[model samples]
Target: MQPVRRSSRLTRNTISAPETAASSSRKNSRKSSQRRIRCTPPPEDSEPEVESLSEENSSEEEEDMHEEILPKETRYENSRTAFQGLYQEKPDLLRPSKKPLSARFLTQGARERTSTVADAGLLYTVCDSDSFQPSIVREFVANLGDAEPRGDGVAVYVRGSLIEFSPSLINTMYCIPHCEEDSSWMDEKLDKVCTLLSGNRIKRWEDMSSKYLTVTNQVLYKLVCSNWIPTMSYTAMNAERLRFIYMLHLRKGFNFGKVIYNQIMRMAENTETEKKRRIILPTLIQQVILIQRNVPPDNSDEAESDFPKLVVKDKKAGLGSGVDSKEPDLEEDIDQAISFLKGIRSRLKRGEYPIQRKNEDSESG
Candidate 1:
C-alpha cells in the first residue's frame, strides 16, 4: 500500500511542473509585446519626420551653393563698372605715350588682313587731326539721348532736331559694311587668342605681355594697342580691347557697325553719369556732324600737304622721343597720327597692297 501511494504522488508532481512552465512562458510573451509597443513609433509619424529632415538638409545645401555663386557675379559686374568710370576720368590714359603710334609700321600683309574690319575707316580717319574735332565730339555726346533698348542705335539732338543714328545711318556715313552675325562667339575666341598669343593660359589682362609674342604678333599687338583699340595701359591690355584685336585678326564676320554705335552710346552714357564731358572716336562724331550740316570735308589736298612728316629718320630717335616726351596731349597725338596716315588712301587706291585670300582649308575644318 505505501509503494503505490508514492508512485501516484510522483506522477501528480510531474504534471504540475509542465502547467507552471506554460503559464510563465505566456507572461513573458505579454511583457515583450508591451515593451515593443513602447519602443517603436508608428510608420506614418516616423516616415514624415525623416522626410522633413532630409528636405531641410537639401535646402541648406542649395542655399550654400547659391551664396557661393552670387557674390562672384556681383563683384565682377561692379569691377567692370568701376573700370569704365576710371578710364572715363582720364581719357589720355588710353594712349601708350605722348608720341603717337604711326600706321607706317603696318605691313602690306597686315593691312590686307585687317581690311575686313568694318570700322577700319575710324582708325584711319581718326588719325587726321582736322577730322577729330573734340569740341564737336563733346557737343554731340552732351546732346545725346538715351540708347535704344536693342543696342543697335542712339539718338542725338543736332541743331534742335532729334536725329536717330541707326546702324544703317552709321553705315551710310562711314561706308562700313553691314554684318548680321552674332558677336557671342567672341567670348569663346578670347580664350583661344590668349593661348595663341601668350603660349600659355593667361587669365588676367595684366599678365599678357608683348614679350611672350613672336615678332609678327608683336607688330600686330602694337598696331592694335596704339590705334585699333587704344586702352588705359599698354602693359596691361583690357580684355575687351584684346577681344577686338582678335576679331580684327581673324577677319571674321561681326557687327562692327553696332559695336561702334554701342561704344559711342556708352561714352555718352558715361558722360551723363559722371557729369563730365569726354570724347572718343572724335572723327566718327565729326562725320556725323558734317552729314547733318550737309558739308563735305574741306581742303583735303591742302590739309594733306600741310601735314607734318612722320618719317622717323632714326628708329632709336623715335623710341627716345616717346620716352623723353612730357605727358601726351590728345591734340598733339592726333596731329602726329594724321601726318603719318597722309597719302595712305591714295596708296591703297593704287593697289599697292595685295588682296587677302581666304583660308579654304581652315574654313572647311
Candidate 2:
C-alpha cells in the first residue's frame, strides 16, 4: 500500500513541470515581438519633418556655393569703392601726385577676330535687345585677347561660356557701310573708339544720364572728351574746367562767339577777392581749344593753294568791330596740328599713305 501512494505523487509533480516550461516559452516570444516593432522606422506622420530638414540643409549648401562663385571683377569693384570712401576722409591722400589707378582693361579674345561690320552689328543688337543705359555703349573694352584667323572660327568667352562664331555667321548679323578706305582701317578706328569709350576708368554716361540721346552721338561725345584722360583735380583744368569743356564738346548747336564771350564775361565778373583765390584753366586745355579753333574747315578748292585768302572780321560793330564767323585764332600748337593734319590728308589723297621706313627702303632709295 505505501509503494502505490509514492508512485502517484511522482506522476503529479512531472505534469506540473511541463506546464511551467510552456508558459516561460510563450512569455519570451511576446518580448521578442515587442522589440522588433520598436526597432522599425516612425509612422507616416513624421515623413514630412524628415524631408523638410533635408531640403533646408540642401538650400544652405547652395547659398554657400553661390558666395564662393562671385566674379573677380565684382570683388575688385567693391574694393575700389571702399578705398574711395576711405580716401574721402583723408583729403591729403587725394593730392594730384597720388595717381589713383587710371583704368582697367577687360576684353575677350574673340573680339579681335570680329570684323568692324560684325562689331557694329553686335553693338546695335545689344542696344536694341536690352534696355541697357546709353552710357554703357561708351564703356571701354578691358580684356581683348588674341583672335584666330579668318575661315576658322574665333572662340569668344562671354556670358560665362565659350562660343564659336565663324566669320560668315558674324557677317550675317549686320552689313557694314562701305567707305572709300579699306574696311580693315575703318575696323581699327571703330575698335579704338569703342575701347577708349568703354574703358573701366570712367563709369558709362548712359548709366548716369536719364534722358534719351542718340547712341552714335553719345559715342562721338565720349571720343571728344577723351582728351581729358587724367583726373582734373591734379591738373591745371581743375574739376570745374574739365566739366565745362566736356559739356561744351557734348552740347550741340551752341554759338561759339556767344560761348566764348560768356566765358570771358564770367571770369571778368568775378570779384577781386574771388579772382585772387581762383585757379585757372591748365595750359593744355587752352592748347586744345586753340587747336580746335585754328583747324580750318576743309576747302577743296583752296586746299592745295600756298596762300589761301584769310578773311578777318569783327563781331561787335561794323565800324570798330565786325563779326568774323570763319577764322580760328592762330596759336603755336594749333598751327602745328593744323599743318600736320593738312600734310597727312594731302598724302592720303595722293595715294601715298606713309609707311614705316625700313632699312632696305632707306638703302635702296
**What Cα-based lDDT does every candidate model obtain?**
0.56, 0.36
lDDT of 2 by residue, 65-103 (tens): 997897999989999999999899897775655433432
Candidate 1 stretches with Cα past 4 Å from truth are 1-130, 146-152, 162-164, 198-206, 214-230, 275-277, 294-365
Best candidate, lDDT-wise?
Answer: 1
> Lowest-lDDT window of 10 residues in candidate 2?
135-144
* Displacement of the residue 176 alpha carbon in candidate 1, Å: 2.4
lDDT by residue for model 1 (1-365), tens: 44668778899999899999999999898788667546566567444577789899999999998877767788999998998898999877766554433554245655453453333444443344344544445556777764333345666665455556766676676555656665754585544665555544343343455454444455455555544454434445456766666666565666656666777777777875676444656655666667667433334322311232232222221121122223335697689789778767667667565442235445666
Error of 1 at 148 (Å): 9.1
Report, for all candidates in order, the number of backbone clashes. 0, 17
What lDDT does model 1 reach?
Answer: 0.56
